[model samples]
Target: MTTLMTVLGIAVFAVGLLISIAWHELGHLSTAKLFGIRVPQYMVGFGPTVFSRKKGDTEYGVKAIPMGGYIRMIGMFPPGDDGRITARASSPFRSMIEDARSAAFEELQPGDEERLFYTRKPWKRVIVMFAGPFMNLVLAVLLFLGVLMGFGIRAQTTTVGSVSDCVISQSAASAGKTACGKGDPASPAKKAGLRAGDRITGFDGRPVTDWDTLQNDIRRTTGPATITVDRRGGDVTLNADLIRNQVAKSDGHGGYVDGQYVSAGFLGFTPAAGIVKQGFGDSVGQMGSMVHATVGSLVNLPERIPALWRSAFDGAPRQPDSPMGVVGAARVGGEVFSLDIPPEQRIATMLMLVAGFNLSLFLFNMLPLLPLDGGHIAGALWEAVKRNLARVFRRPDPGPFDVAKMMPVAYVVAGIFLSFTVLVLIADVVNPVKIT
Candidate 1:
């Protein structure tokens, strides 16, 4: 029964993934059709078709892989000189091809010849290219709004839920002592004079509303010295010295694992953080704050990427509880589905996650590479500006150039995507992102 339920949960997540991919592709398809561009094939997934159907002019199908979807526009690639599109358009054995490329331009039935995508206005073409990311953005915003208006939001309070079993060593603990030796605090925590039971209310004037805020802020601390606490509701301030936390965790083997740690100047004080409910009108505020937090994370990616890469490539294996991936997401989803959370809260949580997923999709897709919505948007903008500039100088309007001309960019995009996939797979195998 447990196995079956787990399988079912994965299926649900796969469905959601399909919906996200389809919604992104649908944005392009609908907008293209609105402008009368020909869409020869519309497909979900990649690789050979497991299922398919032929519509009026388009062949609709599902591919073997469940990662994403695409709509193949006629003459989309290779300045038309690549000859693949033209040859395919001219191929005699088109129908012999599998469904993955089966409905491509060359394979379209005779009646479907009139609506080639290139015939559309440049503006429409541009819109078609951008619609996917646009849809992703819309999805994200609604997700935020839904959680806010429907179930309300929660804000973090300074009160600790429970201190973690793992103390941040060197965090105001006594030197040469593993456990705050003689109460003479070791390094950073001791130098800063931080103590337990002190509630940190501010850091460098940034209000520490809750544990989440505090931790996230701490990661952002660079070349900093200062700590403020609201000990028993009384304000206490001290200069914080930078210190590192090196935790020696168990390898689960007979031997201990050497844990190289990351940290800032800790005042030795720690508190468990949690989400407490916010008021009705404040749900909107909750959305805004959460977004702010996420955006901050994104901005910090350049630095964080190094840590992630080191963790991945280092000789030591990564711990499973480190971060998240599909496995973790599925676990969370399954737990929610089985939870006793009130309907509103449950729904809100689910929406928030989905929204985050969609938002991440949007950000990732906008990376300005081929095969992604961002890549096309980037290409279209380049072409539009170049052509329009030439036109203003009285040069004859050039005919549509083949996007296939951008083949190099396309390959680079493919490589990046492949790397990301590999990273995710590695993370899944090692960390598993389990909710529990």
Candidate 2:
């Protein structure tokens, strides 16, 4: 049964992956058509076509490989400086440029002269290229908001789960030294008679509904305070002398890291965690944190390649923060499904994973490098800048920047990306990250 569930999870994730790819291509196709650009083929994969249907002027199809997709827009590049498509070249780099130009004009119909992508205004071209990544971004935000506001997330509540027996510093407690020392004193919560399952209602005469606020208030107050609790259908009040102690505070990224401590009033009670719906503001804030973390991860990717290589070949354990390819993500989805968790929780987690994937897609594609949407946008913006500068100086308008000239650079970038992808794939298979 567990194996079946894992397979089912993988199948579901595969479907979602295909849908995301299709959706991404649809953004390009729709925007290109809207701008009167002739997109000859709208493909959802890179390899040979498995299924296709020619409708109107475009051939829509699904390919065998499900990794990525594209829309072949006519005349992606403007003509050469001579105002005509350049002929074949002898040099390898020149051949790459000519090949790109040929592909851009291969399906150019007679009337496509006006419908070419490069003929459109710079702003329109920007929109056409930006639409794909923007779609992924929108999907990510919607999914994140849906999960956060609708299904809620697992978080600590005001109800007490455990009370510490003795006052221990945060660093000491983290090091598996929880036992009371000879000179240690009882924790404030324990000394105040707080017990498990007691739902904290008020702190220091102020009503508290959530754990964060209650925790902050407790940390700030250093003197005696009234603690109101709802226990056994009765309101109970107790006086507790708060003590100044070292505690681990939030690092603002949903985690508490070492060396980030503060001197605060310690309650020494662990809050019970449960699924709690978040407000729109809180959801947005969480999304911002996720974006920040994702960007940091991408920035640190080069520094992590050595570790990844070691894990792939040296039998080293996979780091939790290690980068994952599609295979790793699908394996994680399978693990999430096979976990001994409630169905709703599993579904929510799976959705969150997909949402994070989409967010990463958006961020990854937005890098201003060739073969990506952001690269084209950058080209168009550069062209606009050049033309505007020419106009300011009372000079001839430098026509659309010949983005085709950057074919060599684009090839190098693509090769590096492919190499990195293969490395991640090998690492993912060899040292797959465990859910635990």
Candidate 3:
């Protein structure tokens, strides 16, 4: 039964991925047509076509590979320096440029001279290229908002789940010495008569509504303190001496980091957890933090390649922060279904996974590198800058920027991306990251 559920989860993710790819391509097709560019094909996948249909001037199709999709716009590059689209060159780099220029005009029609992509103003070209990634960004934001406002997130509450009987050093706790022994001092919570299921209401005369703020308040004080709790529907205040002790450090999200200890005031109680829905402002703030974190991950991607290589071949443990390919993501989706959680939680997690993937697509495509949507946008912007400078200097029009010249660089970037993807695939299969 678990295996079946896992397979079902993977299938669901695959469908969502295909939809995302198709949606991305639709943005390109619509904006290109809107700008009067002739788009000959709108494909949702790569490799051999499994299904296709001709609608107007566009042939819509789905290919065998479910990785990515593209739209073919006619005359994407301008003619060569010799004013000929069929020009041949001897040098390898020049040949790559000429080849790209030729492919851009391969579907040229009788009236396509006015509809070529390169013939449009630089601003229009920029819009056509930027629309695709922007679509992914929009989808990501909507999905994230849905998950946040609809399903809510599991978070720590002010209620106590467990209380320690006696104080012990973090090192001793790590070594399986958690049980209270002879001569052990009673913990502050225990001495103050704090018990499980008691809801913490106030600390030092200040109201406590959340666990994180309460935790920070506790850590900052070390001497005499008062804790107010709601017991049997009555408010009870207890007095105790908060001792300075070695405790595990928090991970900044109401969770503690393993093997990381610091000297702080110890409260000796674990907070309860519950799903709490967030308001629009809070959800937006969380989304902003996610975007910042995702950008940071992309920036530090190169530094993680060596670790990925070791994990793929040396039987090393996969780091939680390691980049994951589509395969790894699908496996995680499957695991989400197999876990013994409530149905709503599983669905929420799966939706969050898809949302994160869409967000990654948006950020990844925005990179100003060749073969990516951002590269074309950058090229168009540069052309606009050059043309404006020429107009200011009272010189002849410089014409459209020959983006085909960058084909060689694009090929190199594509190769690097492919190799990295394969490495991630190997690591994912060998030592996948586990949620548990």
Q: Tell me, what's the RMSD of every candidate? A: 9.6, 1.3, 2.7
Give the range of the ten consecutive residues with the poorest summed lDDT in model 1. 94-103
TM-score of each: 0.62, 0.97, 0.90
Model 3 scores a C-alpha lDDT of 0.91
Show where candidate 2 strays beyond 4 Å.
none
What's the TM for model 1?
A: 0.62
Model 3: which residue pairs collide? none
lDDT of 2 at 142: 93
Find the candidate with the highest lDDT and give its number: 3
Model 1 misplacement above 4 A:
1-8, 78-105, 108-114, 157-328, 335-347, 434-436
lDDT by residue (1-436, candidate 1, tens digit) is 5565456556666777777778888898899778766777789999989998988767788899887789877644322433344334434333222221322455445554456665565676678888987887788877677666656555445553433222345423334544423444355545566665667778877777655567656555655566678777689887765544543332322123444344443434445434455445455565565566566665665555444554556534444434345555666666555565565675676677677777777777777777677776776677677789888998976666555545555666688657756665666555454444
Ranking by TM-score: 2, 3, 1
Model 1, residue 285: distance off in Å is 4.8
| Per-residue error (Å), model 2, residue 198 | 0.9
Candidates' lDDT values, in order? 0.62, 0.90, 0.91
Question: In candidate 3, what are the lDDT values of residues 1-436, reduced to their tens digit?
Answer: 9999899889989998998898888889999999999989999889999999999999999999999999999999999878899748899998889999999999788999999999999999999999999999999999899999999989888899999999998978898997899999889998889999999999998999878889999999898899999988999999878999998898775578899999999878888899978779778988988999999999999999999999999988898888999999999999998889999999999989999999999999999888999999999999999999999999999999999999999999999999999999999999887776
Question: In terms of lDDT, which candidate is stronger, 2 or 3?
Answer: 3
* Most accurate candidate by TM-score: 2
